[model samples]
Structure formats: C-alpha cells, structure tokens
Target: MKQNLIADYLSCILFRITGFFTCFLPFNISLFMGRRLGDLIYIFDRKHRVVACANIRKTVAEGGDWRAATRITRKAYQAFGQNLIEISFIPRINKPYLEKYINIVNKDNIEAAFKRGKGVIFLAVHAGDWELSNIICANLGFPFILFVRDQGFPRLNRLLNSYRLKQGAKIIYKQAGPRQLIETVNKNQAIGMTMDQGGRHGELVKFFGREASMSTGAVKLALKYDCSIIPTFYTRVKGPYIKVILDQVYTVSRSGEAQKDLRDNLQRLAGIYEKYIRLYPHEYLWTYKIWKYGKERELLILSDGKTGHLRQSESAAKLIIQQLAGRGIKTNLSIQEVRSRESRQGLISFKPDIIISAGSSISALNYRLARQSQAKSIVLMRPSNLSLKKFDLVIIPEHDNPPARKNVVVTSGALNLIDADYLKEKSERLKRSGFIKSALSPLCIGVLIGGNSKGFSISGRLISTVICEIKRSAEELNADILLSTSRRTSPEVEQVIKNELGGYGRCKLLVISNEHNNPDVVGAILGFSSIVISSPESISMVSEAASAGKYVMVF
Candidate 1:
C-alpha cells in the first residue's frame, strides 16, 4: 500500500508538471510534444506495448501480420499522447476555441433526442480525444452530465473533474448510483458515459469475431427509461483539430424479455463501435487486454499424418481442453494435417491461443504458425531441426536425453491415449465385433510385433522362435493370445507368424496389418491381456502397454 501511494504521488506530480507546460503552450506545439511523449512511452513501456500489439494482432490484423500491428500500435500511442496533452487545454475550450478546433457533425441530433422528452444517453468508446468531449458538448448548449468512475489518484481525479465542472457540465459519480441518474433523465438531460472496458461484471457479446465483456448499463438505462441513445465518436482530423460525430440515434428493441433485449441491444451497440474502430484502429485504445475475461479460446493442432505423432498431439490437446474447461472456458479445436511446410494457407485467418504439434516433420510448421498467430507452441518429442527454446513447451521421452531447460519436460516414455475409460470402450467394441470369443481362456497374453527401426530389424527366424515359445507357454498356462502387427511389419516375418500360429486354437485374434487394419485392436489387446510381449522397436507401443498396467515384456 505504501509503495502504491508513493507511485501515485510521483505520477500525480509528473502529470501536474506536464499539464502546467501544456496549458501555456500553443495547441499545435502541445500536440507535437504530446506525440513525442507518446513515442517515448512506446519505447520504454514494454508491458503496455506488448499488450497493445497483441490486441491489434487478434482483432485488427486477424492474427496475420505482426508488423502491421506494431505500426498501428505505435500510432495509437502517439494519439493517446496528444489526447493527454489536450486535456490540460480544457480551460481554454470556449466558443471561439470550439469553432477553431472542434467540428460537431450532425449537431441537430442532440436537439432531436431532447425533443423526445426522454433523456439522451451519449454512448461513447475510449477513442480519439475523448477527454474534450464533455466540454465540447457543454459549449454546444447541451445539458451534459458526465457520469464518470473515480480514478485511484484522488488529487488527479479532482483536478480533472474541476475542469469538467468549470465548463457548465454536471458531475455524477458512478458509485452514487441510480438516484441521480434517474433525476438527470427525469429532467430530460443528456448523460455521457463510456461502454468499453466494462470490467468483470459485464455482458458477454461478440466483438471482432470474439466474445468480449461489454458494459450494458447504457443500453439497460435507455431501454428502461425510453431514452434516446446517441452513439458518439471523436476522430482527430489532424493535430489538435477533432471531429465529433453523433451517430444515428439507436432504436431500442422492446421484446419484453429483459435479458435478451439487453444483450441484443448491447451487441448492436458494440457492432457500431467495432465498425468505427476497424476504420480508425490507430485512434482507439489498445493498451488493455480486450479479451482478458473471455470465456472462449481456439486451439490449433498441426498433424504430420503419422498415427503415433497425431495421437500424441491429440492427447496434449485433450489435456489442454480439460484444463480450460475447469476455468469456465470453452475451446474450439481444429486439426490441420501438414503434408508440407507450404500447406498453411488455411491457417492464415485462424487466431488460436495455443498451437500443438508432434514429430519433426511438423515442428517447423508449428514454429512458423505460432510466430505468425502469436500463439503458444507446444511440441511433443525433441524437434530434430529446431532449437528447443523456440517452443513454449517441449515434451520429450527420457530415452532421448533431453536437456535440462525450463521449457523441457522429460517423460518416462512416449505419450499415448491410454486410460481406463478408453480401454473399456475399445474392448467393448472389439467384443461386439466378434473378435473376442465368449469361450476364450480366462488368462490372455497379448503380442505386439513391430518391424525395422534405425540399426535394428526383426528376422523371420526370430519370429518363428518367439511363436514357438509362446505356443508352449500358452498350452501350459491354458492362455489365449491376441496378436497384432504394425504397418511397418516386413512381409517375411508376417508370413512366418501366419504359418506358425494362424489357425491355432489358443491364438484367438490375429491381425495382419497389410491385409486389414482394425483401429481398436491394440487398445483391445491392452484392455484384456494380463501379460503383454512387445518388440523393442516402438516406444509408443511399449508405452501404451505399460500405461494400461499390463506386465510388459520386450523382446
């Protein structure tokens, strides 16, 4: 608390000093200095600069270009600087000052709204020389009541409010609540309030193709009291000269259902402002997290078309979705099978919060896409060509000898979709398909055969010996066997296994991968078997068996 107070005091002192000089300087010179001040802020304020760029990327750029977002953010900073300096010149905003610098378009709209005998609600967003709006409205002979939230710095807030009060505008604190607002409306006066940055308790509506929380207070009051809502916007025509546009009065829809009516009106109001922001993005405020409390997120998965790698990416995506669900967030999942690095045209417009990929083939694509979209990248297994630091998280097997890094996570084996529910579901499907006989032996042994790997190959003789030993053990223990071959199995070894145990009574299930493939075979084998014998070639296969709690034997 002490630290915050000291910082606030220092900030107030700095603002006062700047204001004193700005008040005496010429309008154009003040604007030039303010722009320089903003440029300095853009260079030094790393935190808000990042926030601004991220906001621009997500909304205006549509997650396409970082350079464009940066340029716009820099200009936005300059505009904000000019706006801050203009606030100090508020005392000079008289009739001649208004005529010289301010141009009010559709000035008759205010008259028409008051002619309705219901109060007027001036709905505005945090955009373009907004501090001078009430003064301009008061100078135009409109009864403007500035309904404002108190700032944390008490002295600064009082200082700013005094300027508004001196311009024939009445003040209504937000905390003073409904009574004064009702009175202001009863007298058919106009109340100015902003609808952006609603904070936690706001209505969720779609803005820039994403759900953003927006304040519904303006819409709610307009609906309940039959007030005319004039969507007001300010644009800097040039240095120190602004155009105040009073948009067409919003026609409130009365559906009699309060909640639906409130949301629909708010969405329409947001749409009006979004259109303007798209046209003049540099004039709008982009320093805050626009979607911070948003409840929706998009997840993109880049697949290499290999079964093992795709499954690992899917597993990671599943865990992420679960975690997001716990936070009351909904996730939209999209899978892109990347055949080549150039196969990324479809992902250009997708704005994802996270991008997940596995296998070396898609790692480069993942890195590039994450950089383009500004999403967090997660890679499974150590990427062959890319540095580990490139990804936000790296999941590697312990056998790979992963380095000790903050982003590196070494797991015991490869990731797989093996769980009790998954096993049970696959097992039931296999049983229903008549792959598992009812009269089968109670004890079951599963055999998983994989083919060649780096510097390793399975010979036909080795398979013959393995099958003979398995036959002898099955006869002694009265156990049934479930066997499946991988897609990489050699034809010589596959034929040897068929000749050895094809029609044997103990060998109830035999799947030849080249002839036909059953997606559920492996999971079903792990689901029912007590002992599992797997070739040492595949880490993914062995990991799946061990994860199922089966006694695994490697040959």
Candidate 2:
C-alpha cells in the first residue's frame, strides 16, 4: 500500500511539473510538443488508429499517396494534441479565463434553454476545441454537468474532469458512476454530451451513404427527463478563440412504450448528424470508425458484390453482411475492382471471394476491366437498360422495378443502412441518458438550416420570420420549445433568429453551429412535435424529419 501511495504521489508531482512547463512554453512550442505526442499516440494506440484508418480510407482510397495520407495522419495527431492540451489545463480555465478563448455566438439560445423548467442537454461533437464547451457554458452564468467516458488514464481522467469542474461544470464520469449524470440533470442542472462517437451498443444508421453506428444515450435522456435538448458545436476559425453555436431546443412525445419511442426518435436524430458531416467534410473527424460496430464475430467476406449498377451493388453487400451477422456470422469488408488500372493492383494485392458492380463499376471504363480480374463479376445497376448477360447476377431497387432476370435480386428499399428497429433502439437510449425531454403541450420544433448553398440562402428574412413564429408558437401554447439549427446556418441568420426569439418572453431555443452526433435533440423534437416545421428547399433534411413516422410540416 505504501509503495502504491508513493507511486501515486510521484505521478501527481510529475503531472504538476509537466503542467507548469506546458504553461511556460511558447504557444507554438507547446503546439509542437502536442503534435509530436499525438504521432506517438497515433502509432501506438491500435484501436483508435484502426478506427481512424477506417475513417481515412473511406474518403480517399487506401491506395492514396503516402504523402497525402501523411498530412492527414499528422492532422489527426495535431487534433489529439490540441484536445489533450486544452483538457489538461481545465483546472486553470475558469469563466474569467475562458473569456479569452471562448466567444459565445448564441447567448440567447442558451438563455432560452435555461428558461425551460426542465434541464437542458447540450448536444455537440468533437469538431474543434470541444474542451472549451464547459468553459463557454460556465461563462454564460448557468452552471452545467458534463457526461463523459473516462479514457482510462487515471491521473489524466481526474485532471481533465477536475479542470472542467473548476470551470463550473460538474464532470460526471460514465465509468465510475453514470448515475451522477442522471442525478445532476434531474436536479435541473444542464448536462453536456458529445453525440458523435459510437456507443458500446449503437443504432445502425446511414452515414456518408453507408451503414454507420451512432450513440443513443443523448436521445434517451431527453425523452425521459421532459427537458430541452440543445444543439451546439464549436468551429475553429483562424483565431484560437472559439465561435460557440447554439440553436433551438428539442424534445419528444412519450405516449408510453418508452423504450420503443425513444429509439425511433434517436435514429431519426442520427440522420441530422449525417447531414452535418456531409456539409463539412474537412471539419468532420475523418479518423473515426463511424461504420465499425456490431458483429465482428461474423464470417468476414470483404467482397465487392456487383449486381446491376456498381453504386447499387453496396445493397447486396450490406444485406449480406447483416444477414450473415444475424446468424452469428461476422463478415469482413473489401472492395472488388476489375477496373481503374490502379484499383486492379489493390484488388489483386488484397484478393477476396465475391465481386459486385454498381453504376460506377459497369461503365464503359469498367466493362473491359472486369474481364481482367479473378473473381466472378456481379453487376447490379445497368445503364442504357441493358441486359446483364455478362455478369453472374443483377440486383435492382424497387425504384425502377425492372423485370427480374435469372440472377437478379429485387429489393424494396435502397439497401442503405437504417431501419425502424435501429431508430427505435436509438430513441430509447436518449431517454435513458436523461438528455431528452418530451411534451405534448407546446409544439416542439426542430430547425435545421446551414451553410449557404446555390439552392438555399443561409440568411434571409423568410428564415427570420420562421424562427420568430416558432418562438411565438411556444409562447402561445404555454409550452416549452425545443429548437435546433445546422452548421451551414449562416452566422448572421443564427443571430437574427436568436434576436427575434429573445422578445418572445422565453422559449427553449438552441443555437448550434455544430450538431454533435447526439440524436436526442432532433429525435425527440421530431417524435413529439405536434407539427414539424422545416424549410422546403432541403429535401434530405425534410426526409430525415419524416423518418420519425410523424406529421411533418415543411415550409
């Protein structure tokens, strides 16, 4: 016992010593050390690296040049360094001090959240200096509780959590006692959670057009607590100072069947997270195994199944993976490329059993190339409505409802991920986490608008009016409101909405420049809202809200 105590004492001393040195070093020098440390961590941490590599390969091909990969590799390291440094200094980051780094972009949104009788769930992601979340909230006057997983580093855990607490956040550890989070929030204290990372168990959803698992606790909590779910995130602009984005509040309707309702709501919430990642690719944390979860025990077949069109081929692959895993058969994933001269090398080097082709694969470029590969080709989708005489099988969605040939498999829905069951599961978790609050009284509204696009305007008078009406509706109903926006939402537009809502007495208005992967805010809003009001231009966004199996009112 004495020896253990001595070691613990020594480690604490070392942390203090290092902290002092870190504080004194020039910012650049500290940043350099952070990058170097990040590299060491990236190379050494097998699990995190595996997740990271999976994320990386999805964007650029695995055969991408080492030079380009190196830059991303270093950036991952840099991000880790930034996260570490900021977290370590949590002890020193009081509200007064946080003012130097955190700039509140949507103060009124947060104020509105506090005004709600129920507690608030601040749902966000790890896009920028996420550690600053606690500090920003602390400076805003309302103290909060932060629910987080302990990274297993004993001193580091205590240090980081302590720092957040010092900044006026009650850091609730998921491992030692997650109930503390429930207790804190139940006391009407604000709870902050990151929505992006995968949970031990997750709801399978579509991300980047593929099957990805998402955390469900955020949604579950909101459902159970009858609280406001707030959408929030931070963007790293040129300055070290952060721009905190918060928008509208969200809550769900609970008509009993708590578990089923929550999961459905959460899966729908995951859809919102998917849209944000698509909108900001560079800002998205690319080094995460967003698609890595579930039955790793199933038989692994890394085949690139080809049906009709190459793009549609993934349907077969996804169906196969799930069906096999369902029978206790885990599978591995691989791409089969008989075309793209460079892709051929990758395939041969990493041979697998089956090959599938979709639209991109059966093109004129790939037609001749398939003859060169070893595996049998399965063409899924065909252009020119041609017969798949050359391929083994063809798979098509009900979209075309083409007449089936010998090897064709007809599916009703596009074989992308996400099912009602997955949605149900996610919704339940959010309820359990107490991050969700549901009500039938006032209309719960979810707002998703972001970066200006050629087809849409981020800032406009119409949008401002919509926000004002939403707030007004909440006031008239004598009900709490849940409101949220997206990253693409213009800074000006966000401000206008917040400004307009400030006059409405008080409503739970959440302004999120960043939507952490938490589904609670959006899920509950869609699930409970008497009528979901959305912008007409963003069809994808509209469809996501529709996924809840509710009445969706689009403007």
Candidate 3:
C-alpha cells in the first residue's frame, strides 16, 4: 500500500512539473509543440485518437471534411497546453488581478443562485481553460471549492494546488466523499466540478453516437444540501480573451421525488456540454477516449423478410440511401452478420440513422441485440421483452397490428428506391436538351411492374399479356404505348418488353435496374406518362408515381 502511494505520488509530481514547463513556454512555440505532440499521439496513441475520431466523425457526418476533423483534434492538444499555463500561473491571481482578467456571463444567474445562501454546486466541463474558469469564479467573491483528481506528481501537485489556493479555490480530493463536500458548501461556499469525463461508477449518457460514462455526483451533492446547481464554461476564443457563459441555474427541489429531480438537473448540465461540443466539435477535447462506454450508433441487419416480401424491402432501403446520397448524405450498408457484432458491443459502433432490421427472423435478435445498440433501437416485428424501453421503433407491416411508436415510419405497402423528383427533373432536362423527344399520342399505355412478391411472380407470361392488352388499348384509343416498370421489375420482363416494343416507333418504354442503353428511361416515363399502371411490388415506386402528379393505375 505504501509503495502504491509512493508511485501515485511520483506520478502526480511528474504531471505538475511537465505541466508547469508547458504552461510557462511561449504561446506560439507551445502551440507548435502541442500540435506536433498531438500528431505523435495520433500516430502512436491510437486509442485516444480513435475516440477523438469517433467524436469528430459524428459532426463530420453532416458534411464536415476529414481534414477539418484532424485540425480540430490537434487544437484540443493546444487547448490542453493552455490549461497547464493557466494552472501554473494561478498563484498570481489575487482578487484585483483576477477581477481584471476574468469574465462570467449571466452574473444575475450566479447572483440569483448565491442569494439562496445555503451554497451552490457549480458544474462545468473541461472544454476550455476550465482551471481558469474556477479562478474567475473564486475572484468574483465566491469561495469556490473545486473537486479535482490529483495527478501522480507530488512536487508539482503541491506547487500547482498551492497556486490554486492562492486564487481562492478550496480544492477537495475525490476521497473526501459526500461529508467533506457538504461541509465545504454548507457555509454558503460554492463547490465546482467538471462533469464531462467518465469515472469508475458513472452512469451512461448519449454522446455523439454512443454511450459515454458520466458522473452524477454533482447533482447528488446539490440535492443533499438543498442548494443551487449552475453550469458554466470558459472557452478560449481568438486573441487573449475567453468567452465565459453561465447557463441557467437549477435549484434543488424536493417537490415530489428528491433523487429523481437531482439526476435530471445534473443531466441538464451535461446537455450544455453536448450542445457546445456540437457547435465546435473539433474544438472540444476528444483525445481522452470520450466513447469508452458508448454503444454503436445503429445496427442495420440486411436480410430479406420471408413474409413481407424480400426484394421489395431491400430495394426500399436502398432507395432511401440512394436518394439521400443524391442529396449528399451517406454512410454504408452491410449484411446481417456484418453488423451483428455491434449488437454484442453497443450503440456507439453501428451509428445507424434507422435500424432497418429486415425480416421477422431477426426480431428476437433485435430485442436482445438492440438492447445494447447505441442507436434508437428498431425492430421489424413484434419485439419481445416488450417492457424493455430500449426498443425505439417497431416496424410491423400495417397489415399486422403492432404497438404504436413515434420511431416507426410505416409505408402504405412496401418501400422501394427511386428518385421521382430527380427523375422528373432529369426528364425535363433531356426534353429541353432534345435527347429524347416528347410527343403526344392518342392513347398512352403506361406499364408499371414488380418482381416476385408474396409467392406471386409478375412473370414474362403476365408481361406478354399486359403488353398485348396495352397495345390493343393504345390501338383502340389511337395513342402510343408508354411502358415502364417499378424498381423491383425483373430484368427478364424488361428484356421481353424491349424485344416486343423496341422496333415500334410509337411505343416508349422505361426500364430500371436492368441492362439498358438508357438509364433515364424511368425518369422520362414518370415525367411524360399520360396514364400509368404501376405494380404492387414496391410502395416507393407507387408513391413516386403519385408524387409526379401523373395518371396512375396501381395493379
């Protein structure tokens, strides 16, 4: 035990000495060294870098470039340097000097909080010069006692902690527990704590796409003392200035449930960190393994549902992803086995927008596996363990009665992938550019198709009949035949249509996902069809057909 203490003491000492050196170094040189050190860590300390990248990836998912994420990560290292500098210089912060340099927003919030007079629990995160944030609070006539974890260095810890004391911060080591913390704040003194980092027994909270361990001690402390809890942070902006903001204060209320309110209030403070982190995600410190406990974002099981029709659902998700891609949103897709590990791990890894857990076969897995996933859990069937609140969405076909949920986006029939608007717009461009001439006819016969569904294959036999009927219909109306297919139409049927109709000048055909000389055929059909007959295979194609405001026949 003594040897263990000795090692811990030495570790603390080494941290302080090095911290002091970094703090005292010239700002420009320090920044240069900081970034270089970050690069070394990025290359060698792969774990922390992975966390930083994960955090960066979430914000970057919205179109933030990879290079920008890298730049922001290195900036976190530089911010760490500033933290050391601010702490090393803490001794120089007398009340007058402190008053001149420090600024806190929402002073009224602080004053209103202080007026309660029992004490205040000030919550914050290590987002910026957090040590400096405390100095300013101390100088503002608040006897602030900071809850801090001691490093493994003795001399520097003593030196640095002594300086912290000089700035009027009453520091408390973690071992002091609830009694000491209550006492410190009992005499109308404020207790300050940084709540962003994970701890041994912390609860999990959503950060980025995963669960991260977050301490609730500060909230617990405030409730025990019936004091006020306030969250504040000081972020380093351009030049030598810092932007300090004190958020709304929460009073420890016991109107009904005492402990419940406390947890909620602490969570409120944590949200402020998440809010700010998103704004300048690159600026936030992510090098400390922020996602150590987070679950995967999403787990998308790529499977074909036996009952609901396989090719149709697969085509639907693919359609959404394709449309989103056209609009520049992207991730990736994988088979059921590929994303299954995320079920074992948690939510942070999969990072799904929506878990399209295709097929009823995987419904049981969704219950067990989704319980651990980070994303809003989605299952395709009636998820068992119905009491498990983790299941965010249950997408049962409307035909079957499933429990109501806000997370579900049910289709009228089945989902398919097709960009009707993009298709329509492209058709217009082609018409304007004169690639495919649009000519009016006496009778326009539009053919909409689906592949195999619910044991019914829309065969070439059926297509040959439909084609013959359509030709007769067009002949009776003295108009041309306009042939088209849903996204799920088999290539064989499309080939049959081309073979039967290609030589005819008056007939026009649009085929999708088939080997064809023209990819814009589907677009032209939707844009120009006077009357349309669509297949029952894909709801998405029917919907797209409807959206074009064209004449539609859903068979």
* Number of the top lDDT candidate: 1
Model 3 off-target regions past 4 Å? 1-44, 59-61, 95-100, 151-156, 208-210, 252-255, 294-297, 300-555
lDDT of 2: 0.58
Candidate lDDT scores, in order, read 0.87, 0.58, 0.62
* Clash number for candidate 3: 29
Q: Rank the candidates by lDDT, best first.
A: 1, 3, 2
Query: lDDT by residue for model 1 over 1-555, one digit each (tens)?
Result: 777778778866877787788777778998999899899999999878877887788889745577888899999999988888888888778998888888888988888898899999999999997879878887788688988887777767877888899999888999986799988898999899899887789988898888888988888889989999999999999987899988987869988899999889999999999999998999898888787778998999888776667778888899999999999999999988878646666666667879999988778888887765557899998887889999999999999999999999899998888999999999889888886645567899999999987899999999999999999989999899999998889999999999988778889899887788878889999988999999998888899989999899998
Weakest 10 consecutive residues of candidate 1 by summed lDDT: 340-349
lDDT digits (tens) for residues 393-512 of candidate 2:
665656666676787777554443234664566556656765443323544555555456565675568777777676676667665655666656677776776676644444444545
Q: After superposition, how far is residue 448 of candidate 2 from its true place, in Å?
A: 63
Backbone clashes in each candidate structure, one number apiece? Answer: 0, 80, 29
Which should have the higher lDDT, number 2 or number 3? 3
Better of 1 and 3 by TM-score: 1
Which segments of candidate 2 are over 4 A away from where they belong? 1-15, 39-50, 59-70, 175-183, 253-260, 275-288, 294-555
> How large an RMSD does model 1 have?
4.3
